[model samples]
Target chain A: MIFIVLFCFISFPEQRNINELKGTISMIEHERNDIEIMLDNVGMVYDSADGKEVTALTSVTMDIHKGEFISLLGPSGCGKTTLLRIIADLIHPTSGNVLIGGVSPKDARLKRRYGMVFQSATLYDWRTVIKNIELPLEITHCPKKERHERAMKMLDLVGLSDFADHYPRQLSGGMQQRVGIARALALQPEILLMDEPFSALDEFTREKLHVDLLKIWRKTNKTIIFVTHNIQESVFLSDRICVLSPHPGRLSAIIDVDLPRPRTMDIKDTPEFTALVSKVRNSFEGV
Target chain B: MKKLKKLLTSKFFITIVWVVMLIAVWELFAFHVENIKRTPENVQPHLSGIVDSLTSDRKINGSQTALQMVIENAKATLTRAGIGYIIGIASGFLLALFMSLSKIVEKTSFPYLMLIQLIPILGMAPIINAITGDIAKSRIIIAAILTFYPVATNTLAGFKSVQREKHELMYSYAANKFQIYTKTMIPACIPYFFTGLKISAPMAITASILVDTLQGGIGLGCLLSQSLKGAMTRYVFWDIVFFSAVIGILSFYIMGIIEIMMCPYRRTGKR
Candidate 1:
């Protein structure tokens, strides 16, 4: 009887592990079927002050899957930021349609399903760090106590609890951008749209933030669309990098990054990382 | 002790020293003039004469001393200017909001507003006085007219100065027009609004006094005119001029203090 009891105890955990594996398999299958964002031949045109029509984007078709970290990688004047803005419903596409989670971008925006971080921190100087993070919640009429709790949580996530009461002017550039990230995440939106959020920072801070961002992605598991002109940065953080060409910006290639999870800064020096970066760089050539 | 030492070495202390030097030079020049002319009439009063006129209890003409009269007139002038300044700022804020909300209104009206600003307040004072009839009301009207343009322009600039990304960020949150104004635009406009007030505050006082003097009412301008009519001594006249200048400087500092208080983040330090 003692032998049988030991057998049961040992086998029980194995059964639970099998069940957990099945649950994960089902979750992955569900995610595969879920399309978080879809763009169908989206294009944008601007009427210059001199009466000339400038094509900012042309035929940018793509699909971003659920919980995916995608980067719109390109050089200057590539309309990557414009595309991000289009996804956020901040600007209207002159042609084609953008659907976020099977609904119009406008509808999704109205529902508060999207959060955006700009290249600049864009924090209000009058508000303290925590208050700036709570801005979106305040605009949506969330209860004051709940807003405070969520802002504190976001500050913790960004490792900035100590500076919660400090003003934006009091913070360094990297810290300010961290606050910006915290603010964007405060609303707990399903999709985060970042437009070159760390491009303004120095390399050291940028690398630190990249690790922090991946950790954040792992924890939150939210769909992230990052826009950047840096080749290695695109290869580093992205699950998939969409390389775009300028002079009427258009998508040229989609490269899937098959790197390991919870990637560290050491991964940046690896041969696989350099090869991926070169591939993204090569896409920009001959265009 | 350390704080006191810091204060002694500060900009405020240096300014005081310069002002004292200027007064000393002026006093010496006045003494020379008095010695050469052998009479106080038609010449600027020395520092001692001005000080005597300021502190004396004897009535200059039939009322109180020159200092008391100057104080009384300043109260009336400041009250009118204060009322006019409030009215002008409130109206200018609304007008700026209107202009910022609609580009059509701004484009149509801004040129005319500039034209009106170009026409001097003194030039319009007579016409306003004729229209209003009452001297006090006309003075207030003149002050408001002078105060409006700078406030409106500055407020408009503040509204326009908001970054495009910031506005887009607000838009992404589905913030309405009113929310955008109150939450982001208005807070951003505070510094610029104060800048406008700084320019307009002194002008409001000057306009009130000018209209009062021109239209024959009770104020520093009236005091100056009455003194010029040989009712007061040259010393008392110089005292009134100095008092008006002091009032102008005081109003500017008051606006600056209020601005700093309203937007403390503008202050930069190690932390």
Candidate 2:
């Protein structure tokens, strides 16, 4: 009976992986009610007629520990978006697999455990700032009064409480993105997947929102997977930066940023921040 | 005042001036030309007696009686047109929504709807009467058919043209299919639907009037026809004038209200 149970447990994954990537995945030890997103030798390939079969992600294995701010840093078309999307359970991988808290993407999604912010603010223009931020709650069927109070608190966290009544177009790019972040924070999910959420804003606005985002992340303590091409921005915001190389993206390096807590915009001027930025940049160039 | 004057000095002002000039020229042609005169002789009137009865007592009745008669007729036509429009638009929206959400609906009903629209509802009036047993009701149905395609096409375009990334964004928030449709897709398409409404609005008025003329009743169209048949050209002219004014008022207000309610994005930029 023990042998039969073990055999069933072992074959469980093999059967489930019939529609998934044909590779192996091992569960990571989840420390708390936090995220442990583990991608095990994750490879994604798209089949073409000429058999080009572009491998968008190739054996890109990485783990995001609980309450960690991780940046998947790469230039455009580096499959960073694809990888982030994989983590979010948005698209099923053609080759590899992902896990959030020892569970598959499907399981993670079914638990209402992830939130995403797109490159564009992706704010519904028809919706007011509060309404847009209230979207996640509405989706998850959060009660009206509590949802409003939480949304207001989130907008306060992003320092846009005053702008809650405004439509997306009424706000600047930076303000729009703040609303996006607030919207993501509405559910207070275990993981926040941001695909270059600040890239649309100007440098000043991006830097400001980075400060805003970091503050909110620390307060909420959710695992954040930030995707960006900006080296400084990634180094500034991320606790660990995962350097990626293009032309079939593969993880080049994962460097832990040893910068201290309650990081401010002033930290960007420090030697540690610049040094870490250069280190991540060197890793990219070294590839 | 100064800013208003400056606004009146721009190319926009010049364009408006040109439009007004063109309208003036058109009105001049209508007044002076042999073909389009509004005299007692140009076209036979429907009920000069009704107008004379209604209008001649302007001093005795405080203009509210004629206003009331005009209002009552306008209200009747408006009610029918309004209800018919709602049904047509609602059906159009449903058809478009069904067609977009599934390939089955698209395949089975979409082409047939297009073909059905092609059969002129104006020409199909007698059959509609036979089916529904009332000519006025038939006219409303015909008007609805005339207005159907635009609303359907616009709604379909709206639903299909919803940004895929927006769908992803909604999904990330754990939005279901229904929420996605109601919140994201519907609102996104309101402006397009309004544009489609603009295209079909005239078809509604014209088709209903045409249908009403085909089978007489107690509408503005019936009044116009009645005046024409009785050789009361003045009354026909007046009825036509009254009908046009009523349509103008309704089209402006109804669509304006819809635009205000559906799309606040427009308000942000302009206001």
Candidate 3:
């Protein structure tokens, strides 16, 4: 009986190890099959206000997998927002191409595959919170009833259904950003591009939002590309942090965050989280 | 009573008090003038005398009382000014839309528009009068010219005031140029357009009156010129001035009310 028990215990781990390797292989294969965004050596250069040529981004090649919460982590002027804008088709790349679901960025944009939240809330002052969420739907000519229903659903998702009738100016900065997130998500786009949506909020509010966002991400299963300069924020929220260097911004390193899912504020206090943050911070050297 | 107290303490009440005080001071000066010098031709009328002229049942030219004639003339002037104001606003808005769509157009036209503003209406009125050969039509044209500058400039500024990010947001939604104009540009421009209208309203009335004075016409301007020529009492002249000033003030307030109504968001900081 002791021999049998020992053999079972010994073989269990080996079998599990094989299954783990197989799982990793399949994950890679699945990721390849479901590549949501692909940037092929994208570059952007434009004339500055003083008529001098400024290179905002160079050789920014990246593959964003479906349903992955990736962050473009960089300092100011590192072209993280620029790269995100390029992917959203808000701006064109000077060189190379961006493919979303194997099609051009512009085509993907036309198909309404991307929902972007700006650094500022960008809520129309004229629109109430619920109406602001309905803007994208209204633009797409969705039925009035559906627009209202979807807007309310988004408000509920952001835990702001109570403030649906409030205008943007009536809300705090954190609440405004929550509404912005709700507005972006209301479109039910395949991908979400957030440009430092919480950078303007206080730390307490940001932490709370981080958990809320994770919950929403889990529920929605939409791929999100968050852009931020904060290292800790990147570590706390991202599945992978794409660290970028300034002075003609380029991707320096892509760090995988192997921390457990459904991350809460408690996860931020872990040694693993701090170590990951420092690794991303060190990537900024020699830029 | 509480509402009345609030009203009495309001800015409008303060303005009324100041106006009454000025009238009282003018009446005191008129009363002190030597009886010999206080003839119909030489002396400024007292406030009471001006009031009497406005209230008098005596006919000035035809069967119309002095007050009736004044109202008729005022209505004519206001109609011309009103037509001119509408034309100015519409054309100026269109010009602003055109200029905002292209930086080159703005650069080319803005300087010339500023130069046109510098050319005084007094100088332009007679020339327009000569070309049109009808003083009434020329008066309308002069009012339009006076009203156009501020509206165009203000509307252009409003259109440009939209943040670049907001524009990008619209573009991201695949909003067409027309959609951008209607949904974003027009609503953004409302407050500025109303501001311009507030400035232009009085100018329109003043321009019409000036044009009428320069080229004799059937309006308050004609009445003023006729009164100045000693055809009417000095009190009548003062009454005309008071009525015209009142019209200008009323037009300005009307624009203000429209502004408040159309943009209720501006009233509260809750936007």
Choose the strongest candidate by DockQ. 2
DockQ of each: 0.39, 0.42, 0.30
Q: What is the Å distance of residue A169 in model 2 from its true position?
A: 2.6
Candidate 2, residue B221: lDDT: 69
- Candidate 1 has an fnat equal to 0.71
Q: Candidate 1 on A138-245: residue-level lDDT in tens?
A: 899999999999999999998999999899989999999999999989889999999999999999999999999999889989899999998888888999999989
Whichever of 1 and 2 has more lDDT, that candidate is 1
Question: Interface RMSD in Å per candidate, to 1 decimal?
Answer: 2.0, 2.5, 2.1
In candidate 3 chain A, where is summed lDDT lowest over 10 consecutive residues? Answer: A22-31
Candidate 3 lDDT, A1-287, residue by residue in tens: 99999999988877777745754554465456898888878999989899999999999888888999999999888899999999989889999767787778898888888888887898888767888898888888899999999999999999999998887888998889889889888879999999998888889989888898999999999999999988898898899999888887888899999999878888978999888878888888455
Name every residue pair that clashes in candidate 1.
Answer: none
Clashing pairs in 2: A21-A95, B44-B233, B45-B227, B45-B232, B45-B233, B45-B236, B46-B226, B46-B227, B46-B236
Judge candidate 1 at residue A158 and give its lDDT. Answer: 89
Q: Give the per-residue Cα lDDT of candidate 1 at A27.
A: 46
Give each model's clash number. Answer: 0, 9, 0
In CAPRI terms, model 2 is classed as acceptable
